[model samples]
Target chain A: MRRLISMLCLVGVVLFGACALGKVEISGLFMKQAGYQESDIRAMTEEFLKMRPDIDVKLSFVAYEELHDKIVVAAASGAGTYDVILLDCIWPAEFAEAGWLLDVTERLSEEDRADIFPEVLSAVTYRGRLYGMPWLNDWEYFFYNKKMLEAVGAKPPTYWTEVIDIARKLKAQNIVEYPIIDAWGQGEAVVIQWLQYVYAMGGTLFDEAGNPTMNEGKPLEALEFMVQHMDEGLFNPACIESFYEEVRRVFSAGQAAFGLNWTYMYNLANDPAESQIAGDAVIAVIPGFPDGRRSATCNGGMGLSILTSSQHPDEAWDYIQYLASKEVQKKYSQNALPIWKSLYDDPELIAQQPELIKVAKEQIHYIFDRPQVPWYSQLSLILSEELQAALTKAKTPKQAMDDAVSRTKEVMERYAQ
Target chain B: MHSKVPPTPSGMYPRGGLLRRRETAFAWALILPSFVFIGVIIFYPMGLSLRLSLFQVDLTRRGAGTPFVGLANYIDILKSGYFWSSVGRTAYFTVVSIAIEMVLGLFIALLLNEKFRGRSILRSLLLLPWALPITVDAIMWKWIFNANYGAFNALLQQLGLIEKYQPWLTRPWSAMHCVIAADVWKVTPLVALLLLAGLQTIPRELYEAAEVDGAGWFRSLWKITIPLLGPTMTVVLVLRTLDAFRVFDIVYVMTQGGPANATKVISFLTYQEAFKFLHFSRGAALSYLITLIVAVLALLYTRAMKRQIEY
Candidate 1:
């Protein structure tokens, strides 16, 4: 009994220590390319604390693939595991509908709201209620080897057919083994990359009534174009399992004349320490179709949101405001693409990231987003599988799209009931 | 002849009455905590899942209350091509991995049984693969199977074994087999270790007698070693079968059921249905179905081993 009493006292002391040391904990992904690394975020938190000494902030960084699942399980349990969550733009609708996020619509001033790009700003808004502050505005970009094109006396392709024709010439000259490489693995990466073409062809994944319609028309044409490139040896066969990082590696090694990847690759490809063809690499808009439509880029950005179960939501919101402020965003622009509209034109900012001002301005004009639904994850999986089937020649492009359409319809019906 | 009944420990205490009840109560007290632990950790969640499997529970849309849909989730799963394909993939993975692990493990176990130079060091070093965590092993194998700079293709090219590099994880069949190979490499050491313990328990005198009777090594192995190792092999088979059937980590890390869902096992599908899709009811039903399959496999193996041991 005496020992038990001492143990109880020890436990009480530890509990007291825990309570005394408590702070508002938040979590986000740590990707160097996205500029959300732990060291960078830690520095931001240190700066945040200097302004508000009364509030203590704890930051947790997980990998990009793991952050979403961690947030989902924690928020689903209403466990207050994190106060602030950095979310992919696609997740805002699902999380907001689940009542897992604290609405911040009225929290923003009119000027503050107007400064953000309308397209990016709307991604984190579900049904006219803002749940997140748009932070990193990342999207896909086309990278090409300028030296390779120049050697063949060719300019960068403005259309898909032009790209293929250039690829044939480059291959014939033995300039590079494969002319085009993309991150076309059997995952969401491939789906997002493929959507650029689908959108360029003026295709919608779903009808306005929220039913899949990728079986006919331009979507099928886009898919067939992708498979034909692989069959014709224009696309690197290794792309069947390559993700963005692998694509970057292939492009940086000067093994491919053209590559499709996210914005991060631009910085990496130009860095002499990271790339073999740093001097030769240049960025272009992803090519459109033969019909003279604008090339589309997928809406790929992330935001910071306050979880509904936060113990110190006001403090979390303050931290988000500071991070999303123009000054700090300007400071971090070297690491990531900032979402502020004014930053695009700011002389100092444009001088820092010249490619952002010159190319991304046009890239922003053709932004396309995935269908926003609670079942988006399932939808991506179903569609990617069918795409993979076509890529692997298990089914023709038409059959694969038809299968994807029917399976997606079934998923919709199930969710509807 | 009538057998004499043994007297009770205490003549003052009745054998068929209050004293026996006291003993029963004492036994219950000893086991009650363990029972409670199992109930909370295992049985309770199982019961909850069984209940949830009959409901339409989508936590994303919480305003839509979970309506009861008895057997609907099960029916949907049974009819779904995705679920059935995953089940087929899981069975193929389990059977192929177990066959490979058993044969490789048995050979290793047999080799280690013989006295050799540095036998003790070899025994400890053989466990290095199993000692590493599954995630670490899977990541290492992922690099090896990479298309361009992977050691696998590089080695094959250097050896003049193939004309060019193969994208091992891009095709459906190759991706499935690569995942299986990783699983086998990580777990074969464990099977060997378990069989090693069983091998040590076999009496040396039996081998000596077999040798005296002019039995060759192969003859003795076929006639004696295998016969005595039946129970152990059966145990290994059941355990490895169950483990392979519920495979997740290697597949998730390597291919993620990719190259057209060829590597997607039942567990991976269950995770997608429950976590990614947030279809908790369907996930629960799928999980219980998996549990039923595993339970049946375990029961059959144990029953077969019992009969074999009796003979």
Candidate 2:
């Protein structure tokens, strides 16, 4: 019996030692870019471990939809299974407010803080506390076929009305099957597109009292204008039912003359192997209102947040700082547009990719964040339903907006206290 | 088979009754573990779901105290337009899909029941759709219905059916039809298998006797095969109806209740409310409404089964 007990103890020690040697797992949802892959993360980890070999890191990738669902489940369970998590820019308020993230304000240095774009930093902060470090910066951009525009005797539109006129000309000349296409599906893309018009028309979804004012005159006017454009055949009738990939397919296939898409689509549209109109695609800022005021594009990207329940908070903080460093940012920006202002101004990289650098500079000032609330996801769904109702002609714009405002108010009240 | 014995010199009389009672108790003890397992695994979660449906709880709201709201959740669900719409949609889907599946599956089962060359190969081929995962099935249908470049449109255009490709999933009725078509493809095999089992159980003597009476093939099938298959058909319809009412994965993967909420079933709505919207209380309410619907259908099925069995 004594010998058997000693043998069991010896085996337990061996198992525990093996577990202690296991690598630290860091999981994230990476945006699929030109050269971003598991090897790039492995290379970064190896370099970081050269200075501190005591900590080991492993990486996991999730698709965008899966990532959102996984994070919500993980955070709600308070399992602390993920030591480091990648969160979208708009998620910090909800995640941080739920106490799922560690407050990282004191961990970051003032110099490191200054290195990030102000808009990006502000987006991830809530109630004057930094909860995450910005990793990437994304904004919507306009993609137009230069050859198609030239054939139709139209230049790239600089204003909303000019865009409609260009679409009309393109249609008349048969330069493109669909003159314009945007992601109007019941998803985040539609919300972003709606924000563009809302901001252009100087409207807001909420007031000081936190009541949704979407039914008011200005927002209604903007929505009506959007519906009218669809009615006038300035945009594809199917745009109201399209997801990102669908719109991307149309634009890439040269069926659409103009498209509003993300910065990452620039490379995809310009790749001759993937695109028929490779050399003809031109990247420009999303068109502004006719009154010379540029409309705002929804700012989207990911941030590094340490799980509050994490046992290895210190190590996780180290990883966050490493990811936020200027050197790492520059390296990552080669494939992804890092949120650091220093990397955006890097001369050598900019010389290689002038269009990307130009886009980064142009969109920086026009970036706007979505509503930061714990129930933002629910609000987004409600808004999408209302928008779809109006687009499908099932309900008048006023009726849909009124219903949406009432539903939002009710949901807010339910979660109030 | 034995009788009680007289007492011995040591006063140890035959105590067969007590001994038999003890043996019975020992046997029950041996089977108690399995009973405990079934109770814990199956009944416990069901009981928890029932209790949760009575409370006002939001999983996303960390540290919020859940209050006992009694039947408020259920009442709210009954009163809400969204809940009724989803319920109506689920019912419509369940009735349409089950009816179509039953008729097609019965026909296919009858075909396979006949002796034919390559019958075994055809049987195996029919099972392929059911054998594939729901996600794969959804993706296959999605590609088949792709607006610009899909096999369906290609076939149609080749036959000069239309001038341009039709957006099958972009239209309301077409989207629902597409989902139903995919569902029929996936579930018909199970229905056919069930009907095949029922067909096998019919006594060959009855068919021989019917032929002796000069009953034709169609008459034998109508009078003998279907009558004897009534119990099995009831079971199949009940099972299929329950499954069809709760369909989620395929629609979720394919359209996600899109094209203006034409395909929004109760399960999908419940999932969206619970996970996507993070309104756990509302989700619980919707789930209970689905349970109520399934229970009513089951009761009706039980009554029909009882009548058939009695006949």
Best by lDDT: 1
Error of 1 at B268 (Å): 0.8
Candidate 2 at A97: error in angstroms? 2.9
lDDT of 2 by residue, A1-417 (tens): 999999999999998997888755554434333233456666776788787667766666664555666776777778776778877776776777667888989987898788788787876788889888876666778889898888877877888889988888888877765688887776566777887788776678998877789998667877897788888776776676676667777888888888888776777787888788888888888887865457567777667788887878888878767866777766765446777777666796687678878876886777777888878888888888788778767789999999999999888887877
> In model 1, where do residues sit more than 4 Å from their true spots?
A18-35, A207-211, B1-30
Quality of model 2 by C-alpha lDDT? 0.79
Residue pairs in clash, model 1: none
**Candidate 2: regions farther than 4 A off:** A1-14, A20-22, A25-58, A207-210, A216-218, A231-234, B1-41, B59-64, B204-217
Candidate 1 local lDDT, residue A1: 100
Q: Is the docking of candidate 1 incorrect, acceptable, medium or high quality?
A: medium
Q: Write the per-residue lDDT of candidate 2 for residues B103-222, one digit (tens) a residue.
A: 999999989988999999998898999999988998899879876667988999999998877768766678888888889999999899889888988889999999999999999989
DockQ of every predicted complex: 0.66, 0.41
Worst 10 residues of 1 chain A by lDDT: A26-35
